[model samples]
Target: MSKGHDFLITVKAPGKLYIAGEYAVVETGYPAILVALNQFVTVTVEESNDYGTINSQQYKENSLYWKREGNNMVFDNRDNPFHYILSAVHLAESYAQSLNKTMKCYHLNIDSDLDSPDGKKYGLGSSAAVTVATVKALCRFYDLPITNDILFKLSAIAHLDIQGNGSLGDIAASVYGGWIAYRSFDREWLKKARNTFTLNKLISIEWPQLNIELLTPPENLELLIGWTGSPASTSHLVDAVGLEKAEKRSSYQEFLDLSKNCLFKMIDGFHNHSIEIIQKEIRINRELLQHLGKISNVEIETPLLQKLCETAENANGAAKTSGAGGGDCGIVVINKKYATSSLIKEWKKNGICPLNLHVHQIND
Candidate 1:
């Protein structure tokens, strides 16, 4: 990277949607596929004269003043409305300091389109996107050389510190962008590394079993998304499933094995460019999630999500609930032979809002 200059630097990180392997992906080395959406969280950094300030358009109350105190950020507000951003800044600066880079006061601003105009989250991994954006923007502001791998590790650690639990495939999508086949590394390993290694050393080392691969969709396949107008808390749903994991260990292991098989088939479908195989695996993955929900006593698919999937099935498309679904969005995989016009119309009539979103690539 070139030397830092007194100029505004902005970075945009895209949000993500899970394609398959939701709950199972939480386990280390378990695979999942996720796509980065067109929606984004943007962060800009510029030099500041006085006390450093953090401003956010999506969260007005989160705007706060802070100052550096011996390499640590001292904030004026204690509520911490923007924990992810704050955590990202701290980690990025800490990494930069380890390299003997100078840290200066800068004003950070965030704007997001990952939510509705009314500030409703679209369940598109806004928190992860924001964390990635913040880290990327600060890296640029500090003139730090960073690759996508280093960025992913840095942003993942920052996000995980706040969230406490998640598969963090969304962080991979945000950092890498586009259609990515992801499997999370061991969080326990990360926790141990944090205590044993420095931020720079931690980022430099390879994370065990963390894999991310960009994928290309088959030429005949297309994707469609429908929002149920009800936002679901992924953390809560994951926690609920975690509670049942111990009692229903056998069932949970079955879910993991089945989900792994289903996702591998879908990935092979991608590699071979077989739309038929992909669609079939999509349906099978849906059934797996349903079985998981039943055994865990968690509603992975809500009534509206069920309606959405059935409507798509009637239109000759394969559909399933996306993410830790209680109520959120469902994804449909359709062949080019099937026109989505009638399916979208049916969704509208049933009160499900069809999202005009596409896969987001890093080059775009």
Candidate 2:
């Protein structure tokens, strides 16, 4: 890809589900399996004559400017919510300068479908998706090749730079656009780079100890998502878990080991397409999550979610809350014959809206 005249670029990135490994992944650095949803956060970019501006109808703003110091951005006066978008622009511009090319200032617009008709977010990793989409839009605007590894690096850094949490499993799934088994980046190494390296060096450096593997789940595997009609703050849940881990190290470590074992078995089951293996391992994973919630005093599974999971299990499927899990959604997995009539009825009776979400397949 090569830069030329000014052009408008629109990039869409899929939101992600934390299918397995949430809090444990942050502290223990174990692999987290995530699935990209069909829903997306969209970002549009093109050349602008004035100082850079970022807009978002969904975010209810316009003309969020990108002001900068020598290399870093001046985020003090501008709005805080668009920090991810601003970070992406700075990173891309810095890299372009590193290549001895000047980056033209651009206008950026952001949008997402992870929200409800009434404007409630469903905890679908919209921040991560937007970060990835921002990078994609900027790269395409500047005609940069968005290789998988490079995309991961830019998106992960942008997300982490603003949010200050997340294992970047969501970033990986959003960038890769499919199901993936991802391990967290080595933060010590990345932290060093963050402190000293220029944005140019950050983009060119070879990423060490980062692992991302594409996964192909069985064709007969089925997933059902039920929205709990409640919005959750993932940051709050993550912080609570972090504090609990620090206070109760041994207990947190025990839960981490158990969940890691469950995730490995689940991955193996996916590879072999063994229904029994997947079912048993998923059930074990659910129980361990419950144990974690109790020890940490975080409501990993709300009552509605528990009802949803229990109902699915009664219908011979395994289920659990998909993410940080205060009340966003729960996921159920089963065979192709997952026409669980009783489970569906129970979910409806409990006020959970069955969402029309499914696993996204990456395009070749």
Candidate 3:
């Protein structure tokens, strides 16, 4: 964390998935199990003389530059694909300024291995990963503390400002980077505390009692992830479900309770590599997704997703839509005894792309 030196700072944060508990986690502070993946979004910061610039392949523009306006770095162009990066920079600079520190102008380069070869997002928490990486890299470039507690909180607050409402399990997974079980922070509480972010208040205010735990996958646990050739807007789906939760209170609560149970079981199954427990829980979880979809009148499991799940079931393995579903990646896990070559081939024949993914570890 030495300052007054010219150096390039790069930080990579891994993408993540909610193995279970999606809708329920948004209810203030509910538990969800999220696993960080090998795919990552990385941010690199280097010193510049006049103004700051950011470059990324994800954006159609591909290059973004900003100049400081008084005490802020305002982008030359406001609407772009790289708002996550800009938001991170704004929050970090604001946070640092609050502590009587200032940042240097730098060229920020953002890149990711989180996309398929064809450049489709697989619903792997790309926004969350990018935000975490950007904030962490900026913190390092400016010689700020690189602790998980600091990084996670900064990234979560910045991202929440954009999305308005999210469980933010993705932020935890990217910061911690592993198979983590997370409970949402009290959104209501954060709303009350947003405008009072002095260092003393940030220190004294207890963070939402988040329950995040690392778990080891069963030694024999084998997982296969595949994309349905379509991406889902998690925020959009969450909003739809939120509306339904308000409209149909009793049924939504029932869905929430069932999802909570399934998440706990999946965590236990992963701990012991119990195929029976894992497989059973995944089926129940899928049913819960379908039920929610029905009640919310949203397509949780797309036709392609349903086909993939059905194929996995016929192969005697467990498969379900991961993340926000609708149209994104589906995960299948089974005991090593089952052969998956044919199943994978079936998935491809049906237009699903298999992803070479694994659980990622925390970056040291």
Candidate 4:
């Protein structure tokens, strides 16, 4: 622990769902909307004597015993389930060292509620949440002077080093909380800058083309999320789409243009507090994703997901797949005047699990 503070520090980061702009958001400067849900990954860190242990409630069999050898973590076991957490530890410690802070061994305990009782993923961004929570917990443990922006940058670098692609929009939602309009930073510039700049200097500098704006939803708008009972791999879907990006030149560009326009309109609806315009744009964006799936020959919306959307639309709500969408959850935007009980019952009949999640906001 730092001096007199010999207590445990715990931090929680909420999981996220992509509301709009999934594939297009992967490109730099393109915008996307995401929400932080009540589901969270919590990390707790405590000072240890000499060696430390990394344990998780979800992965009890994969607990790790580690010790610091001059700021490097040397684990006793080779099999590690905490890849993103370890990355976050290294990045945050590196930043601390850049400020001439000493490193110490600490026991880290992780707990999560982002999955089902049987351990099936619900398509929420658990990895990003875990990384963000770990980073935040370390910041508290080390008593580092960090803002949300600095925390986001460090977490993003840690995540990007592992995932290598995709927008860090999930990280933004985890960091800032609530509904956010986010644009990705330039990956090419970051790739080079990581090699040239020091950790502290890089985090302090502004990232190119990155933007995040918190938004307030219309008073009448109601958000509903339904799980398809099947988990989808976002990276696999992204990689599959990447193969077609080069082949379908004009079609891909057209998809990007239309998605950009639709998301902009939806963002405007949030600003103007118009539920009608927002729902209309949601329908349009869903169609755009359908076309993209066709061109890419990928199953963006599976049969079950299609049924989930159709049921919500029949209930006078606009719906679509929340993320990569081959499986996982779908989101609905409806007017609060309408009751979702019957609609949710119908969803249950079709094997769709309606998640009782609310928007999570950071009160800072």
Candidate 5:
């Protein structure tokens, strides 16, 4: 293969799931710890005579092209993948400029493991990962003096532009790497705190560790199967909750309080290394999520997911939807004693595959 440029940069950004404190993170100013799953968005940037071209072999066969119009970059949205790529790169350039640096034009290839069906659930923040990866590639390509905080903030801005609303935690986790306690509700307070810690110092801080076992269906434990087939917009879901809050609904307040309690318990479980307690906390967390009305759609909790939850509960395993619910992946914490071959066979019979993800601290 002939090379197109002097340098090629590849960056991978991970997806995230909100284990606890989903709705509350936006309002109560609490920390949400999001796990970066193995699935990632990969970007390849190389110098080109063309202002920019984004190609995703997985999504589309043709390349999406963009040209620089003075200081602005423009793209055509007829091609969805290219539109997203162009938007991401433009944001990256803007981010570079904010750091008192310029971004050079390049041919960028953006790819993601976020395709429907085989891909992880739609709500796992794949778009955020792509934004982070694109920003990192632009930073590297231009040798811009962009810090992790800048990258995170820029990514959040891009996400808001792309999806209308997003939890900044996903972008923060991708840029900062590993586990992070992020609360962006009070930007002024956070902005002041950011001045006190350099990116290098922040990255060097030790994050708490917890043992995560990616369970093999049946051999490890029982799992629930749920598929709504209808894609749910995370922004719409959050908007619904926001309406409840604005209306002064007591249920909304109670759900927020429960989420806070769950967050505390989850943190305690992590700090104390108590798997049993963590499982209990997860159950409470799911219940609170359901009460918030985000998990109300029958499509969100598919018949399969409902069955799996019922089966898992009967088998001493707790199960719930992982992301925004509506037709995404489900999480199950099974008791080691009850994770038997019989349970595995039952799940396979229903076409529900279990992804056992192990949680470990990334020691830099």
Candidate 6:
């Protein structure tokens, strides 16, 4: 444990899910609305003595140390689980210097709620959430001007370094904090357009609140389950898909297009607040992900996951594995009336765990 110092900054970054449009958003430039789930990565920074220390509770055995080199901060990677934090802090320090301010060294303590206490599935956007939190804390610590756009870009850049290939949607949702319609293709265009709209004008904007229910599955749900067992690195997966397309795999192109269409339909459903439409769109999107080679492995679509979907379908609800899908978590949207007792019993009987998530608006 490290002693606290002069200034302390805390930031909470949210997890995200791409409800629609899997692989297509990267190529065709469509907009995807990623919902910010309640799960978060929290970072707390406190200024220490001249020598900076970075302590993280998330990985109990690891810590980070940084030494100021000229105007840059250099760190050793052996003890750090989060190198991106160092990069973000350096960037924040540089930005502070440009504004004629001195950047203070600090001891940082980070704790994450990314994994459930019971050791359940790893949800989507944990890495992105960490990146966002680190950048947010560093900005506050350095007293840098952090606008919504600047925060979004910095988090996205840090995430790209970690995940290799990421749609800026997750970082944007975490930074912006709500149900956001993120168009990476026209992100700059949207930002410029948003600038022209005044608060009075923005007041007329209609953003619908989605009805989201998080559940824990019953033990019987595990009967048909198979764990992909191995974790699929997101960067490697996306790069493989991209290379296939570049090599002129016509099927890959078609899969990408279908994925984009499915995403559009899902967003339209969300905008219209049509649950039936959204359900159908999710099924279509999942199928497209399977076609795109994103969900090919058995671990990606565990037997338990398939059974849950089947059971939900039989019970008038629809479920699918969300996020990067390889042995992480799954999301189910069922009739609100049946979400609690019966469905939960079925899930628990099968040994599947469910998480409770609340969807809320993000403040800029």
Candidate 2, residue 268: how far the Cα is off, in Å: 0.8
lDDT of 1 at 268: 95
Per-residue error for 139 in candidate 2, Å, reads 0.8
- Model 1, backbone clash pairs (residues 3+ apart or across chains), number: 0
lDDT values, one for every candidate: 0.92, 0.80, 0.83, 0.93, 0.61, 0.61
Segments in model 3 whose C-alpha atoms lie over 4 Å from true places = 1-6, 60-62, 197-200, 203-205
Question: For residues 1-364, what per-residue lDDT tens digits would candidate 1 score against the true structure?
Answer: 3333457898999999999989999999999999999999999998875578999997686688988877777888878688899899988998899888877888899999999999877799999999999999999888888999999999999999899999889999999988999999999999998999988889889999999999999998899999999999999999999999999999899889999999999999999999899889999999999998998899999999999999999999999999999999999999888888999999999999999999999973
lDDT of 5 by residue, 70-129 (tens): 666676545465444555676677655656664455777877775454644556577777
Q: Write the per-residue lDDT of candidate 6 for residues 1-364, one digit (tens) a residue.
A: 2334646788888877665555565542655556677778889888866767777666666777776666666676555566666656654565567667765667877777766655434555677777788888887877777776677656654565555565667777787765665656333443453477642232234222211222222222221112223334555556666776766667776776676677667666666666676678767776776666543332345566676666666766656655556555556655454545566667777766555666545554
Model 6 spans with C-alpha error above 4 angstroms:
1-4, 76-79, 118-121, 185-232, 246-248, 294-300
Instruction: Looking at model 5, report the run of 10 residues with the lowest lDDT sum.
Output: 209-218
Model 4 worst lDDT run, 10 consecutive residues? 1-10
Worst 10 residues of 3 by lDDT: 196-205
TM-score of each: 0.97, 0.92, 0.93, 0.98, 0.77, 0.79
**Number of the top TM-score candidate:** 4
Q: How many clashes does each candidate structure show, in the order listed?
A: 0, 0, 0, 0, 10, 25
Q: What local lDDT does model 4 show for residue 141?
A: 85
Number of the predicted model whose lDDT against the real structure is largest: 4
Displacement of the residue 19 alpha carbon in candidate 3, Å: 1.5
lDDT of 2 by residue, 1-364 (tens): 3333256788798988887777777753587788999999888886765466678877674456665455444443464577777777767766566666654666788888988768987888888888888888877776776687788898788778888887888888888877788778777778898788876667668766567888888887887888898888988898988888888999988988998888888889878978778778778877888899999999989999999898888888888888888899888888877677777888899898888887777673
lDDT per residue for candidate 4 within 27-111, as digits (tens), equals: 9988899999999999999888789899999999999999889878899996888889989998988877887788888889999
Note the residue pairs that clash in candidate 4. none
Model 5 CA deviation exceeding 4 Å by range: 1-4, 76-84, 99-102, 116-122, 176-182, 187-231, 294-302, 335-341, 356-364
At residue 340, what lDDT does model 6 achieve? Answer: 52
